[model samples]
Target: MKTSKGVKRRRVEKDGDAVVATKLRKEFGGLVAVSGLDLSIPKGTLYGMIGPNGSGKTTAIKMIVGRLRQTSGGARVLGEDSPLSARLADIGYMPQEMAIYTDLTVSENLQLFGSLYSMEREAYIKREEALLSMVDLSERRDSLVSQLSGGMKHRASLACAMIHDPEVLFLDEPTVGVDPELRVGFWQNFADLKARGKTIIITTHYMDEASRCDIVGMMRQGKLIAEGRPEELMERTSTSNLEDAFLEYSWRDSV
Candidate 1:
């Protein structure tokens, strides 16, 4: 394949680093949603981006997944330039908003996404069944998504995103609206995904969840203020938790 720059491209393999972004930036009419951000995520690692609302976590993920184009700089996913057609199939994205069909049955929703990837009937069926079990929605498979509760809908949305078994997963506030018990289940699922050699990038506001990540990028005011393992961030700040570590970084950035 050839890029617009006339450079030949290589097929992105499923191993090694999964994402690389350099000076990535995004802007609206008069607002800059992301500014001079750089990111790198390795294969099989679970990385988290944590910040308050409107801090650009969603915007960054959108650009990486090709939903929104960056205003400047560049990013490469799975070794190919991001937003490239060849790379789309290897990426799975679940936005903060519900991205499933409300009128479709839980099973139908999963089937719909599986079909989008042109998955074979047998393969789709196997994946759909496993995902339904993982999300603990096997009993709700025939139920219309509209009839499901908020947390059920969230789980269903996640099932849809994973139906194709994409190599890279981008989830934004995936645990929001979920009960504490279910949140633990969700994290366990995340850990299982990582164990299976999938690279996962998640955005969350939950400080406790940040500790579960292999690395955490703390965002504030459209910029990444700190990037390190959760424990490293805490130790550097002399704080005992991610929340206080983030506050320490915010205070340093302010002054």
Candidate 2:
């Protein structure tokens, strides 16, 4: 029943959760990037984390994905410790920044990721083709990443993240720079993945898109201000939209 920075703490347990955290905090020097985040995401859920920039969304993901060590607390993903030495192959992460190789063609990048996963040649080719089509890069497969536009690069990065059929996905601002039309397709893709039983966590700024998530968590100043089904959050605040609901939560947290 203890609290840190006004954020509640709970026992860290997976308990059928695809991702679970308790008192998850990250500090660089005296600044706490994540004050103390308690999170629980059930398996096969499409969870969205919404917040303004630097609200610790990316930092929290980095910690959960095992890319960065946390200052305190604990997290478990897919029943394993989050900071474990080896990342489970069943996890996929799409970071906010471009992570693909700039000098390689889109097809080549896919091949590289496939090889990393030790995929068979035939399976790799099949998955690569499907991913290319999904990201709308089938026509631009030969284009070098360096030559692709920002949005195109983003699409390529997403395709690469899903290359291995990971059961858990962490997408950080995945729709940034994406066209409105393409963004709709991306949401459909996410829905399809969820239907197939994947657990997804995404950080986004678009309140409209957040409203579409199965569960939405609003974050501010490194803490979760509110969380629930999008409709429920709006209903709790008596707000008509996610934006207004989030504003109400943020104001309450600040007071």
Candidate 3:
């Protein structure tokens, strides 16, 4: 691991991976939300999880991020047991729901999150400025989150998540209700993050967005039905696009 200006960089294991899960399972009473799911994400890469509404993408992310415990199996994030508080500073998570202070201004929300990580005033300000620009919310810095549009709120939430500059980011449907232009910007930022050596794990239902990921995992009924680069999966299924490839995999899984 390397350190810069008091920030700890990711520890590169011999395997050069940032996240690893084996047989990860989650159950809610009789309902298996996630079952026997496996994942291996490399450093400095964007990995996407694509599945329908009930496919357990959120459940799996919660387990991996330590917000929710798994019923069986385990995972290692940043080379530590999943969800270790000691490693919290190294990870950032953006849930499907907006997780921001509704009454606070965008800058205040970013400041609060930065304070949570004990960032210094100078560092927080610098990061806040950069993040606001990245999310295209620089002009709305002082606008109360409640007063912003849904798309603006979503962007603010993303800025809050990235304020700490975590090495690993877990984003669940980050572009849910955004317009096409903003969605394009979001993917562009994701690529920039990956270039900066950040490992991003994103869950999205959009086939077009999934195609931008370095690798993608398709899930169904709490199980991962297929995994590959979007083009590779398409080729394997003899399909022309990811949507068709995903449908083919879902059909195969059903049988």
Candidate 4:
């Protein structure tokens, strides 16, 4: 009961879209998690989706990644429909919860993901080394995930997600629990991945991180209320920061 003005939208179509959702909807008994959502993400761009907790960010990503079934409508990734198993090898996903094997050493977990993609031993090792270094976990490569601190486990999970060098990455709050310094490094890593032509979509509550993305979508009550370049959004809302812009949009949407 808050939103009022409808935000301008980008034209959404399948062509050139790395991920596309059309009239996408999801439900859980009486709760409507997502409602008629339409999203378009082009290839090789860093897109950030920001919203309050339970705003349906994770649900949207899971539907896009084919991890969850939608109650209605559809989504396509890399030109294929949902459940993109054929393209799974080309996609990377770092969920909100740690997905790495806790019983395995950092190195072993990386290797397992690499092996899943049928990566050659030499290639796997080479990539593992670089990822470990990128995540600043080289010193902890032999450390068991269960023994590592929470932040370290988060980093290891990121490394595992990127070990195969997927063309597209869906990172859900990748910087959670990370220290400021390490968070900077993670953004740098994301920048490097973007420069390498990877399509990266990240969901975060951090307004600072939203400014770093090439484009951002603001979601509220399971609906996208606004989508645009961060600066454009700020200018439109007469806001000085993304947080303000988000509030303005959410306010507009609520009425």
Point out where model 4 deviates above 4 Å.
1-13
What tens digits encode model 3's per-residue C-alpha lDDT throughout 1-255? 546743433333425788898999999999999999988888898999999999999999999999999999998887789867788899998988888999999988998899999999998888888888878999989999999999888889988888899999999889988899889988999999999999999999999999999999999999899998989999999999899999999999889
Report lDDT per candidate.
Answer: 0.90, 0.91, 0.90, 0.91
Best by TM-score: 4
TM-score per candidate, in order?
Answer: 0.92, 0.93, 0.93, 0.94
Model 1 Cα lDDT, one tens digit per residue, 50-166: 999999999998998888999998888988987868988888989889789999999988888888899999988898888888888999999999999999999999988888999
Residue 106: error of model 4 in Å?
0.7
Candidate 4 lDDT score at position 59: 96
Q: Which is superior by TM-score, 2 or 4?
A: 4
Model 2, position 225, has a per-residue lDDT of 89
List candidate 3 segments past 4 Å from native: 1-14
Clashing pairs in 2: none
Error of 4 at 200 (Å): 0.1
Which ten residues in a row are the worst by lDDT in model 3? Answer: 5-14
Screening candidate 3 with a backbone cut-off below 3 angstroms (N, C-alpha, C), the clashing residue pairs are none
In terms of TM-score, how similar is model 4 to the real structure?
0.94
